[model samples]
Target: MDLKNLHVLQQLMDLSQDCFLVPGPVRMGQPCLNALSTPVMTARGPEFRDVMAHLNSGLRNAFNLAPSEPVRGVQSWSGDDDYKVVVVSGSGTAAMEMVIANRFRSNDLVLVPTNGKFGERVAEMCQRFCNVKHLKYEWGRAFDLYELERQLERGCYESLLICHNETSTGITQDAAAIAEMCARHNTSFILDGITSVGGMPVHPTEWKAEAVVVGAQKCTAGPSGIAAIAINSNFIERVHAIRDQGDSNPNYYLDLVAALKKGGDDQTPWTPAINLAMGWGAALDVLKNESNKVRWDRCETMANGVRNLFLDLGFELLADAEQRSSTVTSILYPEGIDDAWRARLKEEFNTQVIGAQDHLKGKMFRIGSMGETPISEMVEGCKRMIECFTQFGMELPKVDVESYFK
Candidate 1:
């Protein structure tokens, strides 16, 4: 396939022949692809309302926001019915900004902790909306809880924003501990679970988070440009208070109050990306049917396999071992390897992977373990990577890639 001659949309469809392992948007399954082909319907019609209802139900389940006990260590909450899952026709950042706009006032003090690119992004977004106290850390390192506690003790923070999964550096923060801390301080917690929600376990209700944002393209294996937010009763109450004060939220298109009003009838305030919503709904259904434990175990197995395979081949991981994410694995390049190695893996082996962002480019690469990628394809991709390393004049050892799966 001469990719250069093809249209950009055609190129997106043509790529990823053998192995699709980018962090996100990860490779989607056939069901989601079929859903994306469905004909558009009226946003206010009964048919679209049915679609919204289905999508909302599945999304609530995916976030562990519903009154369910099958998820690990989660109990039914009485306020479950008061919770709302709002879908927006934008990316995950849009959802994050919408929640921030509605939840915090200009005088509110917000604490933001950063360890990766997405964490930095949350701080950047909060700065525009409120008084932000930013905490910076080394990329791929875990946050210090004691320091966070000290900050909360000293500052009168109205809320704290953090990313549960830092996909850029493949790190998963200790969200349960953070939530507990937030509860003790009586501060609202806002979580960005873009890459963690469906691929692993996330209980917004149990965590007492005010709002949790998730991207459809990440763990859900759906098309891009769709995102959802899970909000609690307290969040809605605060949003109403903000609205009663009159136009405190400057955003017009990404207004959460308007979204909540329309959500009562299974509708959005404006025209939505109807096809993306269809595909997202189908992807959520698959995640629910498979159950949370099954999906978490599969992702854990794939992550361990990818990490072990790379370790045996003399590569180092970027994130700390204890905090590494199960959905995305970041591997540092060995002595003789460079970014060209990725091109060879894509062109010669038809395998797709992600390069590092910002200053880490050429120093590390990321491989995704989310979605429904088969174990056979991951094994083949690992072997191809080894072949490329050998071509770069690094003598490699014989690795039993299948043993990792076993």
Candidate 2:
């Protein structure tokens, strides 16, 4: 984790290519670099207001929220008031937690699916305030929809919590299917789209999602310390009802009522990381040039190329073919190779892939092709990986980089 060590190590083994293939904080080009040089602006100032509008407009355009979209109750936000985008001063998890704190109390019944780390995290975070019914599944396995329907029939849950893209296991759940299921059961949908939103297509209106959370880092191609929580207009009215009736929430920073009140003026209750917010706005502006479809296609191409590279090298993938994530790809390392194999990727090849989480530690490795990471990096890294793995005694055929560029 030492940057100094990595800096010295990058010049080794004639592997000069540096590919940052972790889930996030992704690489943002010049716009991001330019924002860092800007002085911090007051959250309530006109300059910050314009930047906030720009950032929210990008989200609006990406989600395709227009006059056609049905919005009710929430009308304070600018533009069409289709969706209320709450910019919080924390990592993606902050937005995730905000959804729980704002929507549910101890009396509310929340259903969560546990197939990966993020799903488990949301369930755990919700447990602090509300009743959570955990739907368990084995890691690396695709979600069992039949079982989910069975569970939905078992209880009258207030809201169904789901993570659209579970980064830990590289599985992107089908949102439209889940949304339809929720509609059938008369339940509101809350999605954790931290790894998906900007990198993939997200339909807030079509899916009928109540509130969804995303981070600046992962697919947004920005720095951390900010999480964007989007809530539909209908849900915002319910939030006001909670506050109007004096529903007491002990937490100050995450108090939905206070945040929503401040958000009406394009501001936060507490001082935010202004520089990072500015950088996030810049990132959104950069992404505006190309369509989200193209961005997602680029990510998928790189991901497929990387996955094929490892698969061709005789390494098995962790996720199934149907549910594989376009942003992050996790592959199981063979029996003999330990953590050193991953370390060698950084020190020897100047390429950094993600290490595995609990139970699969040292046995799995992940490569990120999300955000601004281009197909060129995957091609270069895969070729270098073939050479690196050969040194680890796992010899395999080389990848045809030219052919794999989709």
Candidate 3:
């Protein structure tokens, strides 16, 4: 209701501001957007094949397919020779559903640890295809590895599913340890790292996962409509086995075997989002310019800055300090703040953050710092949040957000 604050907020919204702080479908940058605007390529043609080859390789390298390669200069876009990536014409949910539908059968016992919403979704998706055992934990909390190992010791499961970054709660599981347990149990592992893979240093292949599914949005800095799944030789063998026995999943579009068949020639079984794929290649290129560690550090720096801003403003974070995601921060509103703050933020400053769902509603909001979001954008986001707070006539404690970030 402050006129002066409203004027400043309007200026903030118009100040060359274009960045996403709500996780997926982040800014694609000018170059990638330009690529998207260009003519669409034939999904299976020579020109498209060449570029897709590069995208595949860049994607594998970005996902840490192998040990850190020599700090090679930017030369070409060829992917890792040892890895194979499938580009699905759907969101991360599709890729995840594919992994579940293809890897386990109705009789196979599958274990899922659900501490957050994404993990729960994975569990729900698997219920139709496999016999699921829920290792449930409270939302906004980390999973218990001891219990996970005990579940593995039961040796009843043939597949294990986990979300590396549970976006809803901003919790990142210790995938390394989970992988070790899955390996020991001789279980097929599927890691849904939709929000974690590019924003953190994760070695999914080396982690012994059968598949690691990530999306073009979220940490990849591309638009939605495409998801990438990296499959290991072990998983590919299962696909071959299923195909040989004439056993097919009920869902044809989400069939991993069909995807793998086309991926052999760097193509997809169905028509892909060609322009989005092209843009995804550029996004992969941007991350491949430096070490994955460097990119992860960049995301973490912005995430920590956002976290510090929330903490300094007396807001409690949802996840534990050690297990919080580097890509998004789930923040509990400070005292005297309510859910209406979300509408106020958007209306006053064109600023947006995700509010929690179901039970967590009105308890917290999520701010993303992954993809193309750098420190400057996070600083700007913090400024806008402060302005939104002041516009609501709430007195905040003396906290110099920028100086704190500095």
Candidate 4:
């Protein structure tokens, strides 16, 4: 087998032609692509330190944290001291697990509300280190805040973990309301902002989220294999107290304290994917150039455009209308259509979209509105979907696609 020249590789390369609509590992812009190709530099060298500085600042800005000014020689990075932002050489899940590992202990009680795959994952992670109480909902349904409050009113919870955006279901949680609940109860707020941070409104401090995790591959349109966290002083102080009691975090590489200490100096605790950091920093630059508000609005516009396009085609959406996310849109497949439609869309039209996860597989497909994916591309993707559906004996109603985006 000539593995190096596999046809599948060519098929992936063909993606450059146009149309990438998956929920994550989104289409990268030229700037990030150029940054990824830069010659690998020594991770511990001064130049990489500067790279880290820029990356840290970018991540902070995306999280809506106050800007920090670097004080020259003593500490290369010193802004936002109240919040420690750490970048790790792993995916968003690794960052989420790091939070659970460092902050929760066997004796702690945690409340996790699950309505999607990522929400279920947070509960699973918490179960490893703490007593987890799940306010579970059926997939595709929004969480019941009244029920959550009822649970919280019972007291004794040390932390609350939730996903800001449930990518798997294309539902954005009500962070503002949840934040108020967490504050009232005095529970540490941990958020999974993987698909939300850069694409939508994710103000960790404003939401009172003590710990938040973000993925580079999602909203930022950067390469995968890197994730970041934004956490406040309260989280750090609690972790220190836990360490002082001799119950240090089990995983060394993800040890929060060491990571935060090194991060303060614009460095990682271990060898990092330096190229990925450079790429992510470049992608974050694109985010900053547009400004957070405008970027967020664009995402909303894209999401609205995608949703309206699908709905006009007679497709039912998976998420509740009001809770639908600005980053992804999950659409239920029309009767007699299945996952095979996605392949035909890609094979015949050079368009790609994501399939459902878990039990929803084959029953639904998702279209991502995040990153550098152009609205025109998504509109084209929808057109391909229409063509594909027609071949399946389903003729969608004609719609003025331009009106959808507006």
- What are the clash counts of all predictions, listed in order? 0, 0, 1, 1
Q: lDDT (0-100) at residue 254 of candidate 3?
A: 83
Identify the candidate with maximal TM-score.
4
The lDDT-based order of candidates, best leading, equals 4, 1, 3, 2
Which pairs in model 4 have colliding backbones? 68-79
Given candidate 2, what's the lDDT at residue 233? 72
Q: Rate the local accuracy (lDDT) of all candidates.
A: 0.84, 0.77, 0.78, 0.85
Q: Pairing residues by index, what is the TM-score of model 4?
A: 0.93
Better of 1 and 3 by lDDT: 1
Query: Which pairs clash inside model 2?
Result: none
Predicted candidate 3 versus true structure: per-residue lDDT over 1-406, tens digit per residue:
5888667756656645643578877777776788788786677786776666666766776677752222222222224434567778899999888877887656778899988888999989888887889888999788888998898999888888998899989989988888888888898788898998788978865787788899988888877888888877778787778767766457788877777766656667888778887888778778887567888998888888888877877778999888988898899877667779888776666677889977888988889878877777778778878777776676778777667555
On residues 85-104, what C-alpha lDDT tens digit does candidate 2 reach at each position? 77888998888887788777
Which of candidates 3 and 4 reaches a greater lDDT?
A: 4
Q: Best candidate per lDDT, number?
A: 4
List where candidate 1 sits over 4 angstroms from the true fold.
Answer: 1-17, 67-82
- Tens-place lDDT per residue, model 4, 221-282, is 88899999888889989998999898755778889888877776777889988999999999
- Quickly count the clashes in candidate 4: 1
